[model samples]
Target: MALHPTLQAVTERIVARSQPSRAAYLAHLDAARVQGVQRTALSCTNLAHGFAAFPANDKLKLREQKKPSIAIISSYNDMLSAHQPFERFPQIIKDAVRQVDAVAQFAGGVPAMCDGVT
Candidate 1:
């Protein structure tokens, strides 16, 4: 199917506006890949701080860099029925990641307020 002209125009405009920043981001990733850099390269203090709350086994895996760690920032609140279902998302994501030998952490929660209440 052909894209609507309005949608295509908007997409082209967005792409033109983002060209510089996108190119810079790609360049940075290329440089990091060429350097063979990984999060394991962080200083001991920084790494320890990053994994301070992780379980011992997960911490060890992080140090070994054998698996990538994914951070899930949830914005779930029981008071809001719409958002309540998301409370279990972190564990679900963690289980899925574990199946692939990767690790998932509930990094933290973002503050959420109901617009109706405010």
Candidate 2:
């Protein structure tokens, strides 16, 4: 089915507006690919800090740059019951990644505030 004329016009305008930024992003991606993965380019101290909390096996693989690692950043804190369920998400994500032969780490968390409490 054809897109509605109004929708098509809007889409074209968005695409035109985004061209420069899209090209720049693609260029950056190509440059990074040529330079190889980010972790492999890290200095020794930086790499250590990045993998400081990884399990021994994962740390070894990451050090060798032989496997991919996923970082899970969450805004979960005990202060909000809504976010409490996220407490177990890191482990769940780690196990799922392990099944696919990748490593996962709970990179960090941000404090979550409840409007009702404050």
Candidate 3:
């Protein structure tokens, strides 16, 4: 499993931005690695679920892999999928951003939306 250059840049960008405390990042990463699975892992109900990615070592390798199939970043920050395959990539990244928004609300990082899903 060799890493591609594009993926390497992505991994680096995540690290640079998230700037997690080493221990917390490791813990969260472990949790995500154990709890997380591949993006294409299909289940009937999973299509509606939001993904949580924690920056840890095991997952980090996959995050660095060539062609980079999935995203591995802090669960709280919104992911960028501004321009992608007009189909699934947009949805997947939007889902991740929504998940972060939901969690950030509970943590009081951002104000809760009374109107919802703006």
Candidate 4:
């Protein structure tokens, strides 16, 4: 089925805008892909540096690469009504992860854009 004209135009525009970065990102992922345990590819010192700031117990768990590691990323801008609710999600998610014996870290925030707000 054909897309509506407006939808097709918007999709084309978005694809064009994202092409370069998306291609590069895909290439990077292809280059980084490996078999078996990925984290073990890092040197001991490098791995230590990655988890140095973690709590002592977490540090040990991460070093063993046994328990799952979770990165809790959110787009939680307080100014955006749609995103404001996400501010509380990291803690909630971490709490849930802990119940499953996984490690969750608030990795970072990304931009939350609302066209209506803009």
lDDT scores in order: 0.81, 0.82, 0.44, 0.77
| Candidates 1 and 3 compared by TM-score, better number | 1
**Order the candidates by TM-score, highest first — what do you get?**
2, 1, 4, 3
TM-score, each model?
0.60, 0.63, 0.20, 0.56
| Rank by lDDT (best first) | 2, 1, 4, 3
RMSD of 1: 3.8
Clashing pairs in 4: none
Q: Least lDDT summed over 10 consecutive residues: which range in candidate 3?
A: 102-111
Q: List where candidate 3 sits over 4 angstroms from the true fold.
A: 1-20, 38-69, 72-118
Find the candidate with the highest lDDT and give its number. 2
Higher-ranked by lDDT: 1 or 2:
2
lDDT of each residue in 1-118, candidate 4, tens digit only: 9999999999999999999999999988677553323678789888777787677877777877777678888767777676667678888997898788767788787664562433
Tens digits of lDDT, candidate 1, 1-118: 9999999999999999999999999999889667652886688898888889878877787878767788899667677888877878888998898888778888887676662443
Tens digits of per-residue lDDT, candidate 2, 12-83, equal 999999999999999997896677556856788988888898889888878777677888998877767787
Best by TM-score: 2
Assess candidate 2 and give its TM-score to the true structure.
0.63
Which residue pairs overlap in candidate 2's backbone? none
Candidate 3: tens digits of C-alpha lDDT, residues 26-114: 99879876765454565535522322243243234433332123332322323334323333444466356445432111211232233
Clashes of 1: 0
Q: What's the true lDDT of residue 49 in model 3?
A: 34
Residue 61, candidate 3: Cα error in Å is: 17
